[model samples]
Target chain A: MRRPGPLALTCCDPLAAVTNATARIILICSGKGGVGKTTLTANLGIALAQLGQRTVVLDADFGLRNLDLLLGLENRIIYTAQELLAGSCRLEQALVKHKQQPNLALMPAGNPRMLEWLTPEDMRTVANLVAERADYVLIDCPAGVEQGFKNAAAACHEAIVITTPEMSAVRDADRVIGLLNSQGIQPIQLVLNRVRPRMVANQEMMSVADVTDLLALPLLGLVVEDEQVIVSTNRGEPLTLNGNGSPAARAYHNVARRLRGEQVPLHDPTRERRGLRARLLNKLGMAGN
Target chain B: MALFEFLQRLLGRQKPSGTLAKERLQLVLAHDRSDLNPELLEQMRREILEVVQKYVEIDLEEGDVSLETEDRVTALVANLPIKRARPAALTAPSD
Candidate 1:
């Protein structure tokens, strides 16, 4: 039998390029569920892809996986994390590449039973393997302080905590922040999702400043509460890709821009809403002055 | 609209919901970060009162034992004014 060439051996090695790879691993976590962690991950992945980044959103929530569903690629998932780890498929074969966005991909969770066997070390290996081919790997972490959270945070160098303006959400976020800080995760940022600016102005809902100050972390971005998010999500389309000129879409796109080291200003939907009203009134020649 | 705005402004002195939430969170999170739940704090207060009562007479109602944070450092500040010193026998140190 002829021996395989050195090139063939090296080509099949997934960890070969990991030594010199420089991928920014981000773990998107929340202490409370329904805070839009997976929604942010899917939208941010699409936004980063729009910025030409080779991004991979890893669904680290093993027992319950929804990233593929959010990305509208659940049916495209031929091989999962279990198959990849079982030596049945290559890493490239397991990654579900986005149809429209060539740069974005998803590494979905395996069978729920596999959650028991997956360790932090295994996650590190998978993350490192993908880091070789991708520029950014966003891990969608499960809620609460548990094994899934640990496994997700293990491979990530940076983290983003998502919370709403509610006290319970912020309290959970504070606990999650303490947990992430204990784990030595650096440069953790906050995303205030589902903000109602009018309510904030009327002193009903928490403001962005209030949340950031309470959480005591730098603000990454703020997503306004919009019906379009629900509609787009139900349609299995990321709001960033919808091109509907929604405030949440622009905010998510700005988040990706900020991640790319850009100095994009945070989008204020309330201000835009007022500005649009003024423009429409001016177009109709209604001069109150 | 202006009348409603005026009425809101007049009654705005009451604590807003967001501010109330913030205040509650500040207190609860300070305790949470220190790993001291209400139950634990209450238990600790009772134990501290028992220890202090053997040394000196004090009113538990007037005393205070709570958590406070300064520059991100948490401390369980306690204040228990002594009503009267214990007998010399109890105050005396055992060799």
Candidate 2:
């Protein structure tokens, strides 16, 4: 059903020679929905690409796949992993390379109707094939600890569990971490998302400490709630793409750097908010004098 | 009332919502992670009481069995008040 063309493997050949190290197949997952799993996947992919890592983001959330839309590659998807697995298209044909960042490519999952036909073995096959050419394969896992999550976990060597500071999110993250542990996914890390520094300062919301204490995972990065994230999502452009220096964008970049074994310090939202307030107070005092 | 409230806020005497959240989460997660619901815990308490009653005179009303999580490790902590040792248990041969 597919043409055995030499052209399929030609595009990704340069990266294989660039790095001898095997690609890190990481799963980006959260047990609860609306906690920014896809958002993290999109931004992290762009960040890793900017760091010169040839990255392929595999959208494993077939039932409610929107990773293509988030990365702004929705219209360019001609073939998907389903077609590639079915031998209807080549790997290069199915991969939708980012127009802005050529280092990054997206393999969007097929329609929800095909969800029933997909299995964990199919996911591993796709991940292994993509891993052959890239330095990173990020599987955007679906919400919940269901079959979709199992399929995604089957393909990853490690995982990044994203969660908000809310009670429900943290509880769900703990459960997901337990599941990841049972799956033998080593060195699992946590990324606390949508942190509101002012709220935390006022004791209105959970602090990063409270979350980390409960989840008991190594803190990978902290993304303070930035309005720019929503704007960039609507534009289908990840915040890291513009290098806008937004809080969330910086956090994402730091995550990528840390993944590269760089010892970048995690962001402290509480201290950041206090620093901003102190600077404003000093300026106001000077103006009054 | 308003002045008192302002003074309380200025002195930070009021319990913050974040602390409440943390306390609540600790209690709930201990149960959630242990996979031991309240009903199951109650059943366990009854069964434990039945087993212990045969060897000791215990205060069932004051007995407590609950899951506690510390350092990411959940433990089933039970405190059963033993009123007295039964004559049979006291007279049983030493192992």
DockQ of 1: 0.27
Best model per DockQ: 2
* Counted clashes in each candidate structure: 0, 0
Candidate 1 lDDT tens digits, A53-156: 88999999997899998889989999987777676777778889998898999998999998778888778777776676789999999888788888888889
In model 2 chain A, where is the ten-residue run with the lowest total lDDT?
A: A280-289
Show model 2 residue runs off by greater than 4 Å.
A1-21, A272-289, B1-14, B53-61, B81-88, B93-95
For TM-score, the strongest prediction is: 2
Every model's DockQ, to 2 decimals? Answer: 0.27, 0.38
TM-score of chain A of 2: 0.88
Tens digit of per-residue lDDT, candidate 2, span B1-86? 24564345445565456666888999988987888878999898789888788899999889888888876799988899999999
Model 1, stretches more than 4 Å misplaced? A1-20, A268-289, B1-9, B12-14, B43-63, B69-73, B77-95
lDDT of 2 by residue, A1-289 (tens): 1222322454456643433248999999999999999999999999999999999999999999999999999999999988877767777789899999999999989888777877888888788777866999999999999899999999899999999989899988988988998889998999999998886765557888888888888899999999998999899999999999898999999999998999998769686564342344335442111
For candidate 1, write residues B9-80 as lDDT tens digits: 345434446667777887877888899778988999999998888788998789999897543467888999
